[model samples]
Target: MMISETLNCGAIVTTSQKGKGDLIPRAKGAAKLLRIPYVERKRLSLANLQANHKNKDILIFSQKGPQLFTGEGKAHEFHLSMAQLRLIAYDRGETDHLVEALGPEAISSFLDCTAGLGSDSLVVAYAKRSCKKMVALEGNPLLAYITNYGLRHFVHENDTVTAALRRIQVCAVRFETFLQRAKDDSFDVVYFDPMFEVPVTESPQFLSLRGHLVESGFTEAILREAKRVAKERVIVKERPFSSIFQTMEPDELLGGKYSRVAYGVYKVKG
Candidate 1:
């Protein structure tokens, strides 16, 4: 779903109470880029600000980073989530199923069709340092803006993770649009982690992102596009029971024995 369709009243960018001096200008710049109003936070609470602004969604910039607060009051921010643990496991010589499915060879370029919080892309970037080009696509402008800001600014104690975060190029474009424009065999790997038909209730980040997500279903056409663009393979991360496995019929499946999620790999024909 496009943000405009979900957020009928549109959105505004402002800073938290701690947002002052440089923060204000940065907030204004974000507002300008998003083509939304830049409202002064002043002494008003988020609730008060929403009420005054007719309940438009708020993008709050703080000294820490940018956070998106839905009119419904759910807050979305960038966090490493499972990626941190995955990176730690990688450091300990543990294998990640997604990375393993990406193949053992060094990846030259990778495309993540659904960036979400960018945890997967971050992991790929850290695990596959040989990858020279990494692009992550987020359709919603608000989510894209906050995520792009967070990827660039969020500091991690692990310098490698921080560097990996900096390496990903986040673009606010629909996956279908990006795929359509991309030339055949342009990237080594193209990946999709589409929103599950059934939500994962245990994941707070996923729940928070539920409201902002674009409901672009994974289709055969999209699969074809991904395959055409990928020189090596196109991978779709889905629930084991997802119909994509049957309909799209990946060349191979990879997952842990007890894992709920699985990766379906479609090798591009030469």
Candidate 2:
């Protein structure tokens, strides 16, 4: 079978010549998963790649960690402690819209269909420690690999936070495909936080992620599958008055003042 130009166009996996032996295998595996070539070299100059291959990107493995870089001179890597600040705020009595949307009760399991950066998933894992099984699926392999690495390696001062982060299981697969094979009522709650239809262009953080972000949005078919796999309810996070909400009316809505995120919860019918 011929590989599409798109597969090889933007990215090739590479490892630092001085990269640890243990980390080298992961770099090769990343290349294989993305169906891109793995190049082992002494060093990678992102600036040179930007000038040389206009469309090409690089995922470099080093002793520090795996990082994805676009020729645009920006790098996207997973921060293991990304959710720590959020959790801390919650601990200090901040009302987390996502946690509130899930209700106060402890759920046994969670399935995050669109685990962009795995931020929300980490928060859910921390909040619902009683519900220890948290699985996140990312359609973008690069994002998934980075998140998986962070989850395993990120250390935290708080034992509970560290444990929660470690417990999350991230898989590189399309949510639709994963939902199809999931048994009925496999998880207590299914969550979706797809990329906003209106991108946050003003935010440098989100803008940096633009290159690696998956552009797909949710559809009725996906919602249907999510409902089937969720034993409790399926929750969606989006901005207010999103067109998607009109198409798929949720049974409940949860939001807060000055909050950009809102939730649409569709309870599973017994």
Candidate 3:
């Protein structure tokens, strides 16, 4: 698809260019798992799609709101925003702790590899003045549009908290392909916050637009590419009780009422 300018900042991206690096993966058995018709062919955004397409009856939910299902059990509920998570991550000198643990020099040029709604990337941009030249890469086109829209408009105007989002460059591309394009030791820190844990009891406002895309599924390849991209260390966020990262332990513990920030510092002399 071609690019068009929105009222906001840089040109709004909506179309998907079929390429080797494109993230148009057929979500495995999305029909069986998500209980919705899975359109095998990848689409950048369903909003722009022509009316009367396949599975038009089963409308997906919009992802603008804070509601997301975290589990399949009775206790499943919505989680907080990246802003709240960052507050907890920075609380009690943990930002400083993450900086020190990941190495200040290593974090100068950062990349959020699994940039699922571009939330965590915004946090890093706002947390410090030194985090320069940052990119939040999301494979999902609709979420990428949301991320791009919020950065250029809503977030930058209200308060300094969200104002930092504009500083981040939005990349609508697949992670592994980006790694191939990027030079070795290109970024100081590559962060990952994979979609793991239980599905939350989602809200109706959420169910309408976020329908098909929600089942993108967990990606291990993202973690592997994150390790390859970071020159210094890779910091990954995971569920508190049942950790997901199979390799390392968090040298530092950044906690919140619900979630936790677990970081691994891999020293690379670049």
TM-score per candidate: 0.92, 0.88, 0.57
Tens-digit lDDT track for model 1 on 1-270?
122212222888889886777989989977777778999998788889989988777888887788888755367777888888889999999879999999999998999999988899999999999896989898887888777887888889988888899889888888988899899999999999998866667777766557667779999989889989999999999988889898888888999988888999999964
Ranking of all predicted structures according to TM-score, beginning with the best and ending with the worst: 1, 2, 3
lDDT by candidate, in order shown:
0.84, 0.77, 0.49
Off by over 4 Å in 2: 1-10, 16-26, 42-44, 50-54, 80-82
10 residues in a row with least lDDT, candidate 2: 1-10
Model 1 ranges off by over 4 Å: 1-9, 72-74
37-134, model 3: which lDDT tens digit per residue? 33432454333332324324222222332122211212111222546555556755664434444554425788876665556676677665577778
lDDT assessment of candidate 3: 0.49
User: Distance from true position, residue 239, model 1, in Å?
Assistant: 0.4
Clashes by residue pair, model 2? 10-57
TM-score of candidate 2 relative to the true fold = 0.88
Pairs of residues clashing in candidate 1? 1-214, 1-215
Off by over 4 Å in 3: 1-51, 56-106, 155-159, 199-211, 214-224, 240-244, 247-261
